[model samples]
Target: MKDNFSGHSDSYSKFRPGYRSELISYLVSLTKRQQCAWDCGTGNGQLAVKLAAYFDEVYATDLSENQLRNATPKNNIQYRTEQAEKTSFDASQFDLITVAQAIHWFDFDAFYAEVRRTLREDGVLAIVGYALLQVDESTDKVIQKLYSDIVGPYWDPERKYIEDLYKTIPFPFHEEKTPVFHDEYQWTLEQLMGYLETWSAVKHYMRDRGENPITLISETLKQSWEGFDTKTVTFPIMLRVGRL
Candidate 1:
């Protein structure tokens, strides 16, 4: 299971997008108290670090030691090496629990049970994700071909949960309306390539084929990316916020 990110922790830390402040503000408004938050599957402490600014204490846990090692520390955030389904936290200790971009990899039955065990009744649970990124129609075509035709077969089956926007997942909670937000970035071709290098499917394709598959799309991507100073890209950030 940990092998999914076997050696890509560095790329993940450097390249993965961060959550927008609007999402954080919306979560803060929903919580009755901003006492504590538990960020499960907190790979590289991305969201956890941000949560630390709002919550008094932030508990960030992950199964991957290397990912934890790569995490940048904050005074209020505590990092732990642990699985999503099993934790040593006290019962009803968290006012908020967040799972960002990593929920598809969790054992849902075990994780939801743990969430109920750990979260306060008034606590908010936010399952955060983002859809495919878009720069422009032309750039999107190159990316789509690389993602669908080239690396699609290499993606783990669980990725469908993200593709479907978590619609089929069992989320038993009193749902709350959330604000609309998008995670945007102005990145050069190299930065975009760096981000693509962090994809699990790309990693799988490299390991199995003994060659970097992203290289195949370099020429095609240049067609759209070369002349632009820095392409503007955006992802529609999705949040399923609720309470038990």
Candidate 2:
């Protein structure tokens, strides 16, 4: 289960993404029994640990033990190394289920069936996903080139959403986008490099070609920024949900 992320633990933990409180509040409001929630694909348990503060219990599961190691040692968070397609929890066990940046890696049909079997009738299933990044027009031009020209071809087609495709799946579902606000995080050159190194597309590209992505990324970042400080990089995230 933990095979894919076997050796990238440090890159993942230090440079992984996180969610906003606004998204969390919205998810809680949708659930009647916010007392118990299950955080599916709980990478590093960032969102789940925060959720534990809002709920009496949280069952945050992931296939990667590398991720679970950073789950903050929370007593309220029942961390488990369970695949989304094959979790051990009983039917209607959770009042809410949150899937953050990791849903793109799921087996949708199997995952949906499990969600159907596990969530309470009124439970909310908030699925969140982030994109390459957002920045000012000048900065965005460079990022856009990187996304479309350099990085786009290598993305896992199995992972990316084929617009409106999930709607065709046989699950009772509803879709909603979070507030259209950008999240800005400041990054030093090294910190920014670390973030890019964590991207699976970049990792796979280098692996498939037997080239070092970090070296290229470092060279590119240096060339692009004249005198870079901790400038902001905004990322947009969207969430869709429904009761099963």
- By summed lDDT, the worst window of 10 consecutive residues in model 1 runs over 1-10
Model 1 residue-pair collision total: 0
Task: Give per-model TM-scores.
Answer: 0.97, 0.87
- The whole-model lDDT of each prediction reads 0.89, 0.73
Residue-wise C-alpha lDDT for candidate 2, range 1-244, written one tens digit per residue: 2245546867777877677787778778878886789999888888897798789999999888877886677888899999998889998889988887766677778888888889888788887666667655655666555555676677676434623323333435765444554457886667767777776667777788888555644555666655777668777665567766
Clash number by candidate, in order: 0, 0
Best by TM-score: 1
**Which regions in candidate 2 have their CA more than 4 angstroms from the true location?**
1-3, 162-171, 174-178
State residue 203's C-alpha deviation in candidate 2, in Å.
Answer: 1.3
> Which pairs in model 1 have colliding backbones?
none
lDDT of 1 by residue, 38-131 (tens): 9988889989988999999999998888999999899999999888888999999999999988888888898999999999988889999887
Off by over 4 Å in 1: 1-3
- Model 2 alpha-carbon miss at residue 45, Å: 0.9
